[model samples]
Target chain A: MKGQRFLGLGYLGPYIIGLLVFTAIPFFGSLYLSFTKYDLMSSPDWTGLANYERLFTRDRTFFKSLNVTLLYVLLTVPLKLAFALFIATVLNYRLQFIGLFRTAFYVPSILGGSIAIAVLWRYMFATEGLVNMALATIGLGPIDWFGDPTNALLTITLLRCWQFGSAMVIFLAALQSIDKSLYEAAAIDGAGKVRIFFFITLPLLTPVIFFNLIMQMVQAFQEFNGPYIITQGGPLKATYLLPLYIYEEAFKKFNMGYASAIAWVLFTIITVLTLIAFWSSKKWVYYAGDKRS
Target chain B: MTDITTSNDLTMDETARAKRRAGLRLFSTAIRYALLFLVGFVMLYPLIWLVGASFKTNSEIFSGAGFLPQNPTLDGYIKGWQTSTPYTFGRFFWNSFLIILPKVIGTAISCTMAAYAFARFDFPLKKVLFGSVIAILLLPNVVTRIPQYILFRDLGWLDSFLPLWVPSALAGDAFFVFMLVQFLRSLPSDMEEAARVDGANSLQTLVYIVVPMLAPALISVCLFQFMWTMNDFLGPLIYLSSVDKYPVSLALKLSIDTTEAFEWNRILAMSVLAISPALIVFFAAQRYFIEGISSGGIKG
Candidate 1:
């Protein structure tokens, strides 16, 4: 019995070590570091609340990045979810060659958030690039995609939206798992297609929607690659997201203390947002077989 | 004669209704295919363009927006393979595989072991530990990057793959562990109980019974690790500094940075090569890929 107990612990040993070294210690370490002034070369000096103070009081870029990130999350998450849901609905049909379309949509996601894709995006949205070329043929736009500050953020947002396949696949799975009999019953009652979808499908899908929303929101806040490679947070810091700001502060400027403070702020925002999502989900997210509140 | 005319009129009404219904069905089908094609085109255009651009000369790439190269050439592939870096693209590919293979195997082993413990055993602190796993999954990795960097730097493990894959060996990915735990929960504990009754130890039972039953989930874990590691940028960017040690992702970035004229064709070709392994792996085991995603590996 003692040996069995030890064996269980043995199995968990690696994970325990990882938690300590990678997660727990660093988590607290960063929290502590957020309160101190330290560059990589020097030992950290205690400066209680100074980093936080500086961030709140004097950091214009900090607030700008925060606003930009918030705007990004606002724009990308809903749009991506809608796009995913729409595609997944189309895919939910028992159509021939559906796998090909699913794979096609998913291919970009499989190459998700890579430097290569970001680079490809940069060129694609360039002034004389493919997007503009297509626009010209349509007699519509040679719009400056990454040039104008107004449009630069949108460019990056579109890139995030483009990789909606992961969320779509999750939604597809959820849609597939939904009780088909419910749909049959609705149809038998003479419920129109849209009515059944809005009343039945949408309600049942709220749980997955909630999940995707939270995940995508968190991802959008920490988004780096598209802004980093495609826009370089350029055209007047339009896409200077919080994560990039933290990276620049920590590594580029070697202000680890301030960077840690920024990171903690981000951490807090994510946690709060996630909590808010969970709290709000109680109203709409329906889990089958669970008692209604 | 009047009664026969009335019957003909009723038949005409029935035919009209049927024709309208058919038209609606055809219209809906057309709309569905149209939407699928439009979205698929948007999803795939960049990749298709990348391949086409790979064969075009720098000047040719600028001349037209069309995917077809006016003058198709192998110069991009030939030149991109010989990057200006001391190491070639082939070296970077090897480096990627080196990181990917070990990370995948390590993740499978460590995650399965930890998940098995969480699933089958009644251990102390299990609840807290499992909760921590979920919490960690929610925690953005960017928050941990600086402190991890400092820690690894202090340990003199900078500029190495150790900082990258060693953590996987320790089941650092809480997502995979959680996923496997979920998988294990869905499985009946009968085989494991049988093995225990037959005097098998925990490890032996895991190897003999649990592992074989857990093959699909385990394969999903491995596939995800493979694809994610291959496409990972930030990890390699943070940990590695040496050009020789650079993986395909970093190496591709390095080529862009170092090249003065910025040969789009060559860079695109190298980009194609950089992503080929992941694309090939995904296409080959797409079942596992989709299974992994649907089974709760939510992040792309």
Candidate 2:
């Protein structure tokens, strides 16, 4: 018994200690700091509800950021997953150069949201960049992709969607796991290709699709790099995401307390959305080997 | 079932069969080609444009016609290398590498050990601790930044690599820990059990038996941490103030800060130089860059 206890401690001590010092302490500490006003100088004043109240009622940028973030999530998640599924379905077909195609499609996913890519995006959308040049070739005048508020969000959306590599890879794995005999059976039943896709593939792929959707949504909600690098909260705050706002508050403005409040709000929003997703998933998601349904 | 109905169906099929087959072939080919073109454009155009722009002179870049550079030159590359002061391309790359190597090693070692403990052992409070780790993934980094910054500040660890590097020694990456735990759990315990039956202690079994089995997972984690830490900008931007300590990412940003009035050729060239190491690393380890979606919920 003593040996087992000691072994357990030996195995767990470093993790526990690290978690306590880094994660647990910071988590609770930040939660506490949300209620106080400290500028990293004097003693923190415990102001009850001031930060929260200010965010909801008074702060203009807070609402702007919330709207921008919501827009980003809504636009990016669905299109990205759909594109991933489409690519996965296409790749599922046995082809001669499938490996090359897969790698080509995946390279962008790996490099797409990187700071380099973001800088690239900035240049591409600049007034005299490639996009405008392409537009001019067909006698269509150039549109300001990053400069215009209406179009800037779309640029970021497209950027997010371009990195559908991870999701595509996941969908591909799921597609591969599906029994070949199922497709054979469908074909033997005189079902056309479209019918087989709808009746067999789509139904079976629902779980992966749902998984990709939720993950992409959460990730899209927390997206920072593209807008931060490309637009920097935009010509008119069009790309001002909540995370960016929180960052600006903390580091740029040195308002740690206010930033903590933004952080907590973002957390609550994510938690609520995640809860809703889990609840709705019971109706839609079909886990294989789960016989309860 | 009548002969008249059968004859009518036969005639109809015979007339349309050839036409329909031709149409189907055309449609499928079109669909395939269309997909090829669209996906190709989406994947390649931006990257190609970036590469093209990097070689373009200022006047040609501002000219902005099509994907090709009408007057492409190596001016940008030359200028990007020469422009920055106190933060040259080679120096920043070395700085970035210095930070990345330690963080990658730290994450791999600490996260893997923690993962093994979580996966194999049935210690007290294991469930709660595991949950806390996963939950921290959702806890936004911004929330913790202030308290962590303060902690580092009080310790006088700010402006040095310690603030960035030390926590990594103590299982800084919960995502990696969670990933390794899931992977370890999926493997059968028979090997370790046999080793234990032969009088191998838990630590011995872990070091010799389990760690060997976990080679691929460890490598993947290491590569991921290397890329992430290499490309990390905000942490280095916030922590390291001195120009000498600035990593390539921060250095690149500093170069681009004067984007409007500054030379575009140099800026783009420097950006290329800054990101090349990560790009090279990623491409080299490209085969193992598996998108393991199932590992998303894992926390260290």
Model 2: how far residue B253 lies from native, Å: 1.1
What value does the lDDT take at residue B288 in candidate 2? Answer: 65
Cα lDDT tens digits, model 2, A1-293, are 55674466566676778778877898788888899897888877899789999999999989999998988888889889888888888777655566666777777766665577787777777887777777888888989887788699998998888888888878888888899999999987989999998888887777777767767776787788788888998869999998889878887888888888988898788778888987887887666686542
The candidate scoring highest on lDDT is: 1
Clashing pairs in 2: B174-B300, B177-B300, B178-B298, B178-B299, B178-B300
Kindly list the per-residue Cα lDDT of model 1 for residues A8-28, writing each as its tens digit: 778999999999999999999
Model 1 lDDT per residue over B1-300, tens place: 999999999999989988997898788878899999988987898889888999998888866778889889999999989999878898999999999888888899999999999988877788899888988888998788899999999999999899998889999999899989988988999988998999997889999999999999899898888878887887898889999999998998888887756588788888888888889988998988788788873321
Please compute and give the TM-score of the first chain of candidate 1 against the native first chain.
0.97
Task: Provide the overall lDDT of each model, using Cα atoms, as 2-decimal numbers.
Answer: 0.88, 0.78
What are the models' TM-scores?
0.95, 0.91
Question: Model 2, B1-86: lDDT tens per residue?
Answer: 69999999999998798789788867876676568668878688776667777787787776764457777788888767664574
